[model samples]
Target chain A: MTHGTTSPHPAEPAPAPRRGRPRDAARDRALLDATLAVLAENGYGGLTTAAVAARAGVSTATLYRRWSSKEELVIAAAALHGESSYEQPGTGTLEGDLRVVLREKAAAMTGEPGRLIRALIGEAAHNTALAEALVTAFLQPLYDRVAEVVRRAVERGEIPPLDGVELLGEVVVGPVMTHFLLTPRLPEDVDQATARETADRLLPFALRAVGGTP
Target chain B: MTHGTTSPHPAEPAPAPRRGRPRDAARDRALLDATLAVLAENGYGGLTTAAVAARAGVSTATLYRRWSSKEELVIAAAALHGESSYEQPGTGTLEGDLRVVLREKAAAMTGEPGRLIRALIGEAAHNTALAEALVTAFLQPLYDRVAEVVRRAVERGEIPPLDGVELLGEVVVGPVMTHFLLTPRLPEDVDQATARETADRLLPFALRAVGGTP
Candidate 1:
């Protein structure tokens, strides 16, 4: 009952070991790497900051310092996560360019991307800020790359005009994505034969939709 | 709750109100209606059985009576929701039959169906059971319907056969669904012009994908 006597064991022993908030670029990279690791191991909902920090051997504050929320962190991690870097060949033909571009990202096509992409999209559906960030950061770049190929096709007169670029975008990615989003069972790798078949089949519809070919 | 307090709930003064038991037809219909209302108001994630019960003027027990989990109930509500009633005219041609059927449904489409349809698909993304139930109950039916139409088209020598029936299903719904899922602004109507245009534009590709036009 001695009011003045402080406990021998102070609250949070060692004052939680303050590190003075120095920017750890190495820790940040590790955290991002760990985020992808956790994402691949578990889905978007299952991935946690604690797990990422633990995996990266960094304090949780280090993570919070870089990312405002889990969603932002996940998107950033996704951007740097894997073989997202693509090389679309400047083939003389439209189909040639598509085949090259798609085939480049083909092997790196893991199941994780599809699920995370859908989850990110679903999250964006409800969040305006996230949606804008997502479009500007993740989706826009992908769209721009695809649109460039399509534009090249127009220049080569291999396909139609730009009337249905959005629709054309959908036609190219719609089945793959819809299948990915709704059904995760399909294999992601599109081999040459399959890619050629798909191009032959889909390019026609896209052509007509964009007021070309037919 | 307080050491076996006597049951003095005014809501259940006499016979205990049935909440966890099997719900009858009338109760089931009411719950489904309430579910649609809740879904319309609160969206997929915000929708709860409590809201459904409150909206239906039924006890929580009664709400849980027919459905074991909220996921199941939502799926059940959406599963039994569609009207498959149709007058398929044997107009001596596959195109005629498809055009007639789709045109009619398009003509009769309302905002209610569209919203619920979007909500159901949206919810399915997050909830596994909802996803299975939706594909099983809602999407499967649509798939089967379109499959039958394609099968008839083959029989009538309208198109060449393709391997992916599900792919065919996607073609039927994909373009419109693209707008539905991606665009925030919904048109006032499904719009007869849009429907006709979509059906016509997608027809040649659909025919080619299914089988070369018979």
Candidate 2:
């Protein structure tokens, strides 16, 4: 697969489609949905192009025409899932926006989506393709959203225009990632309440890290 | 496997040996060593009791006598590996000590031990034993060491007496972890110099998080 930001897969075309038959949005949606379903049940290792095709009621040729490999398919599916789950809550203040976003992020981690994510994390160690796909499809978009939040915060003078402010997403959510993903004995439910509380506690440190008045 | 801290296996008795032949420390050492070797080569799923026994030149019964399951044995081996790798540095200041510890921790993550850790993190999602063991054996001991450093810093007035100082380890290392474990595009070698630089950048934030003067 060609490296960098552009994904060669038909599902996520590198550029605008030329001609040929215009891409079927409905069929593409079905295939992506089927891919996630297979991943949720069978995990990254168990995911197969043939199975995804069968689940989508499409031929192997159709699946292959969109994605060259299972890795590309899984990545596209994960990206689609992330896009659907992610909501840009323009809550005015930086803290308010982050609180909503972080809560949603934490909830996703504890819910069904989290299972697929964990399975992917495990499989990524062995499959570089999957690892790259995870970062490109899942993490990049989330990072962009976080950067947008910080940008607004900077404009409002809540956060100082520090050099590391651009990378504040990692700093802000590092503790959450450590808690939800790395920590074994997670608290009950790991619901929106828990996420909100965690975000409240850690936000000051993140603010301070970016030279903001916490 | 019996629940809780106590091991039910004959080779891993809760108390001192009663009237049976004295347990061979050398043999136990060899078994643990063999277990890690197998893990480093075969990963968590591929590791087997038979393979470990064969590598250690011990009988399958002998291996099973100490640890009833593959999860238990891998946890013990990983615990042993973590213990050996973790070095406590009382370098006068909290920053100095953390710099050393975090640097070492980062280097380890980019090395052989990291592979096993990644594999376990993946497997632990589904396996409670592995998750519990990861927290108990690997994370707990390291957390203790980190807490000690913060305690000394607080006593010295470098950091204010804070309620959450006990969790400074998580905060100090959270960003490093987010960069190393979560990010796919790792820098070259993930060298000690880079680790130290990252620790330098994040330590002030950790200090500030605990109400310290950075």
Candidate 3:
């Protein structure tokens, strides 16, 4: 819920008396959507608060009231985008849960969401704030979900207790990340068949890596 | 090696007659090094041919004589940087060889090379040409090396034949790449001890994934 480290404009007037919570929510969503659109079109370097505000059909002052900086706006947009794309799998078995998770993740890594993420990652390389925000907003939640799956399996005696459970996140999703990011094809060209096959193929390795039977 | 798709400036003069082969080699190295430096300092968007030329103390025409565009210059520089950093492992055992390779790659992912790569990946998200060049220059060679190691292991009866061997690259090195890139740490601040520890922890999973005993 924290917008970012920087504070919004203190002098900006409060919302109009007629402006309700639902309208405010709608405005926030519109701004975040505009942010993603801008990121997808221009990448991180080209992103600016002015451009986002203009795209959202809002004044710069309004945008500043919501986000103190472009980086914070990006972080917020990415978080909202990721939540919509990611599904928490509750499938009975570990393998089934992983398959659902991986497939969903691969699907997310294509099209506009993928492009926005790449732009963010590119910025995250040198921008500590963005990097940390990415880890916090995206990676940590994904890791926690994976850890929960592992925890369930351990309780069911499906596998031995893992010593370094944190590493499981990388072991499980790293290949998919590599395939999506390193492959030369445009994200839109990443067909579902390829993602499904990749998920099936790597499932064994993932299971083995986590001390589960394939 | 092919520089890139775009040919050098058609009207540009050839190298001076006094320029010996060694000096030409030295000049190429300097230009590539400067490209890396510029990329490290200013990500992909900020990198310019004039900046690289000025950094290398060469005319823009001289740089153009070698690389036709900023993208091509980046590709050439990245190819050279990857070549010098990558070492083919010849350790007798597969585990030992993988450990060596993983450790070396993790080491390379720290510092200037890492920053430059992050910039390139950022650019690659939107630029098809850069993406293909990255795969050819970096990922392909690494995959080939990993395949060779697997081939050796198969020949020695260390493991059964691996189908879709291409995926091995992602399987073995993907975790390390994820750890380095997504960990939110400044590349320079990535200590050797941490790299070594990550290699050690992921080694068993790598072995298991590759169908070898840990």
- The prediction achieving the highest DockQ against the true structure is 3
lDDT of 2 by residue, A127-205 (tens): 6777788887776667777788888888988766555544466666676677677766433346667666675666655
Cα lDDT tens digits for candidate 2, B56-128: 9999999887788898889877766555556678889877877776776776666556666777877886677
Tens digits of per-residue lDDT for model 1, B70-170? 87777666544554423334776666665654454343232456556655555565566777776665555555666788788777666655555546555
Q: Clashes in candidate 2: how many?
A: 0
Query: After superposition, which runs of candidate 2 have C-alpha atoms over 4 Å from their true positions?
Result: A1-23, A84-92, A151-156, A159-167, A185-189, B1-23, B85-89, B151-156, B161-167, B185-189
Per-residue error (Å), model 2, residue B55 = 1.1
Model 3, runs deviating above 4 Å: A1-22, B1-22
Better of 2 and 3 by lDDT: 3
The residue pairs that clash in candidate 3, if any, are none
Model 1: DockQ against the native?
0.15
True contacts kept of 1: 0.13
lDDT of 3 by residue, A1-214 (tens): 3332332222343344233343555677789899888877877878898999899899988888877888878998987776664557888888998887787778777765676777677678778888898998788878888889888989988888877787888988898888887778876776777777787787887877787776
Of the candidates numbered 1 and 2, which has the greater TM-score value?
A: 2
Ranking by DockQ: 3, 2, 1
Task: For model 1, give the TM-score of chain B.
Answer: 0.72
Per-chain TM-score, chain A, candidate 1 = 0.66
Candidate 3 per-residue C-alpha lDDT over B89-180 given as tens digits, one digit per residue, 9 for 90 to 100: 88889999889878878877776667667767766867888888888878887888888888899999998887768788998888888888
What is the TM-score of each predicted model, taking all chains together? 0.65, 0.83, 0.86
- Better-scoring candidate (TM-score), 1 or 3: 3
